[model samples]
Target: MNPLHRNKFVAAIVAVISLTACSTPDAAGEPASTTRRVTNAEHELVFHVLEGKSPALVLDAGGGLSSSYWKDLAPRLAKATGSKVITYDRAGEGESDEVSGPWRVENAVSDLEAGLRELGVTDDVVLVSHSIAGEVATTFVNEHPGRVSGAVLVDANVPDFFTDEMLTAFAPVVEKQKADLLAQPSTKKNRQLLAVMADYAPVHRVFHRRAWPKDVPVTAIVASQTPFTDSPEAAGLWRAAQERFAQARPNRKHVLAENTSHEGIVTERPDVVTGAVEDILKIVR
Candidate 1:
């Protein structure tokens, strides 16, 4: 079969295997909070506020994942910092409405801005972003400088390494799986979600345009193992991305966790992740 047909075939198989077969409702209960929908000139955004005391922190989850993924991480950061926490599902990933086109970095930033406005979180807020969220958060800070007090990147997405060849290779894969991927059951939804992320070169490029603000203390934690090492090239790509962050923000300290994967920062090393948040709080305070 030709490459195009082969990709479609693989996508079909992935769709069947990756359907949301395991998603369970929010067991933690109705979020103990309410979500406000903010409709922008172009998109609609959904966000929930976990009220605390002051100096609110907004949490953005990784790619192909929902805000619920940060369920454990958010409260821990909130309690540790003694500040309000906001976590929201970006469009097409969680309870939030999906956008008509591919998720763009600018759109994600706009969604975050609209959500904050709708919730009335106008203070100097700290934006905490994980994985791909690092890209979105950085863009937000650059676009709206004064709006952000500081930022903490948990295994952030770095774009300097996402070359044109990588994006071209991943585009057909995403186009083929776009449909069934969305229909996936909540549990298995991450399969197609990952595929879509594979095409997110534009989002990654946004990260290269700006560095973490000097006024904003940036914290990054890298996982021990690289997850997408299907090939040596893939492994190098992942390492290059991490290296870009290290090179760009040489002064920024990074904590490497052992026996951990990409999601480990949020799942296995909540203590470490929370510790980093606390460190940011100290600097910002």
Candidate 2:
């Protein structure tokens, strides 16, 4: 072959090799660099930050659950609001550390504050909480009113929703579970840590009496199927709590979805929850 042709062939081969070296692995391998780990107060948290042009939204999961609960709903809200969205598991749940325990409402709030700081979420953010997380969101708004711009509570557990008799009936069951969890050797670490931060009774009582912050735009979405209570009185109590929540806030609103369970409001019925969240965003915007 001519010397010029041979030289051109060698150069082409070298270019191909360079391109291959720069190529990144696909979905099967390590995740994209955009998804990274951040450390909160007492836990190493893994999170996904989806960037956008508008305000930010932070998602908080329910009791004993992780941020995966907001898997379906958060992205939808991000799209509707045209803003970035942050979702992460609390300590002891999902991929986060199990080092911290007791998981009290206040601890949950602290974890959230630490997470937002780590993620550099300094701008005004909308907090979207699900199930038992409603208590955390409300408490945080009440305590740190300046941080949050709006809140969306989906099938939140409120105190007034439980009658005195209902609380009495569940007290023994909760204690039994707490005991059994502590007795198990495998779960001892989580239980001990959880016992320190967890206070279900106080959480219940607080929710019953906790008032919605007048400054924040709050929206509550009630699920059609009531999972915790079987009695007619309990059902009525749940309805009353939702009514009170809607009435308490100046910009509060409530919506009920048909055939959706407590968990389904954020998971199965993303459209329903997203619709309500979009409404709240409209008011805030």
Candidate 3:
């Protein structure tokens, strides 16, 4: 890989991996309606639906992750809210087929759209996005408009979080690790990481410019110990972006997950995630 591309990949992956690694939850008893593969172009994306009712909850995981992240919470959310809960493994992750080339938010949104339509979930969606998947949720909601009833962003990245300054700050650290990142075994997750990094800056720039639909109610749950532990300045920027995004339009709110880390929020502070989603469910209902 080119040095510049490598650097970009490293910069974004560091922040992403720091907050994305976790043990897959046990989904054994989930009230699954179906766990099937949906075709998107040439690749097959796996989707697991915990059946219930309309205004479904769609959970999108962060980079280098799979739907297994929601194993524990999906069923709980379904039982508590009595609304369908959906989780999927994006292409190149989990059981989904990998497609060559850089990761693109547009393609992700397309895959999601196709899968939902196949499942007969055309509208009344309540999106729950985490980390990099925030970009996916933002684009999906915007493109589909009335299809989405609301959204809950769980310590997810807001476009504002990807400022030039932060990218600059990432350079020194990323450059030092070039030899190591290149040397790591090329597993599926590693390949996906590289693809995301290859297109991180440019893709996020577009996301930064996107406006979340004004009518779509949202709640942003931000962790106290964010991904940027090494740099207080960067961490401050991350939190501030969440604040701004929460206040960017009406029907949006921000909740602070005190003492929680980004990676653990979904598991450790699932109540916060569930509570936020339920809040939106109330509004849309």
lDDT of 1 by residue, 1-285 (tens): 356544643443232111011222443522235566667766566676666665788988876678888878776776677688888888776777666544567877887887787777766888778777877877888888888877777766655545666555666665555654556664435543554454454544444556666666676777776554234445456667666666565446667766677665678888877887777777777
Per-residue lDDT, model 3, residue 282, is: 89
Question: What's the lDDT for all of these models?
Answer: 0.65, 0.64, 0.80
RMSD of 1: 6.9
Give candidate 2 regions above 4 Å deviation.
Answer: 1-33, 162-169, 182-198
Best by lDDT: 3
What pairs collide in candidate 1?
A: 20-185, 20-188, 21-188, 22-187, 23-187
Q: Write the per-residue lDDT of candidate 2 for residues 170-267, one digit (tens) a residue.
A: 55445655566567776634453345324555655655677766778888888887543334444566678788868765688888877787655566
How many angstroms is residue 108 displaced in model 1 relative to the true structure, after the best TM-score fit?
1.0
The TM-scores of all predictions, comma-separated, are: 0.75, 0.78, 0.88
- Candidate 3 residue runs with Cα over 4 Å from true position: 1-32, 168-179
Worst 10 residues of 1 by lDDT: 15-24
lDDT of 3: 0.80
